[model samples]
Target: MDDLFAPATGAWQRVSPRLATVRRIVIAAIAAPVVIAGIVLAVLLPDQRWIGAAVTVATLPLAAWGGVWAGHNQRTWGYVENADDLLVTRGVMFKRLVAIPYGRMQFVDVQAGPLARAFGIATVTLHTASTETAADIPGLPSDEATRLRNRLTELGESRGAGL
Candidate 1:
């Protein structure tokens, strides 16, 4: 059963280890404010103190769990490029494997949000004729993301020419 979720046997390139830190930071950034608000409300509103306290108590642990989960999830994301296709595998519980043929790629995009940019990581997205075929691989280093985008574009153009 564990083998089912393991990455395929090949030259699987793992995303940068720093991605885990980025995920934890993002989770904390989002969770901290909400928890703080709950705590403040608990102190300010005496009548609804119980509700606020409950919310604050419940959320803090959940937020920590989310950070841990994000770290683990980031570690799970990996990709491998073969002669004919690129394989991306992710998820720990509901594992998924997406195989995108080089010939099926229509375009490639590289993006980085403020948080990602600060972390020096970017996401590479692949577009195909079928919207369902489009895929994204996040948490790549900026330079690696650029190289991948260029490589995928080149491969897509050369391979898709026949299609």
Candidate 2:
């Protein structure tokens, strides 16, 4: 059982923090308009009262599910640099584990929103050879994200040179 979860050689290191409460708040804030719209639809839409009510009620579960999903999804940001590849695993239910060879790295980016800045957190996005398959490792400390980016960049470059 231990071996099943244990990482192989050059196992993953958690280089990022969990998404902060402020980040959750930011998401909720952005969702406020939709929430309000649902409420208005439930109240003002007379003919479709039942439908509107159902939709409004549905949002409650949706919001709860979304929060839990994000919380669990961002619970861990794993980075494993193997001899020839890097692997990142994230998400809880809809899990995604991405493997990228050093040669496949295009670039890396670090981003911080206002809420993240308030909480001193950042997100690191890794761009790979595939345009749509970017890795978004979020909710890290600003300094840590920067350090990881620099380290990963150096590693990628070194591997590129070796090849």
Candidate 1 TM-score versus the reference:
0.90
Q: After superposition, how far is residue 25 of candidate 1 from its true place, in Å?
A: 1.8
What's model 1's lDDT at 58?
87
In candidate 2, where is summed lDDT lowest over 10 consecutive residues? 15-24
Tens digits of per-residue lDDT for model 2, 1-163:
3344445776667643446476457567756666777778878888887766776677667777767766666665676767776677775545567777777777888898877887788888888868656687777788878887887788778867221
Candidate 2, position 85, lDDT: 66
Predicted candidate 1 versus true structure: per-residue lDDT over 1-163, tens digit per residue:
7565444657668888778887788778887888888889989999999877888888889888987888788877889888888888788678787888999987888888988898899999988888777789999999999999888888988885322
Clashing pairs in 1: none
By TM-score, the best candidate is 1
> Best lDDT goes to which candidate?
1
Model 1, global lDDT: 0.83
Instruction: Point out where model 2 deviates above 4 Å.
Output: 1-6, 15-23, 42-48, 82-84, 131-134, 161-163
Prediction RMSDs, each to the true structure: 2.2, 3.5
- Residue 72 displacement (Å), model 1: 1.0
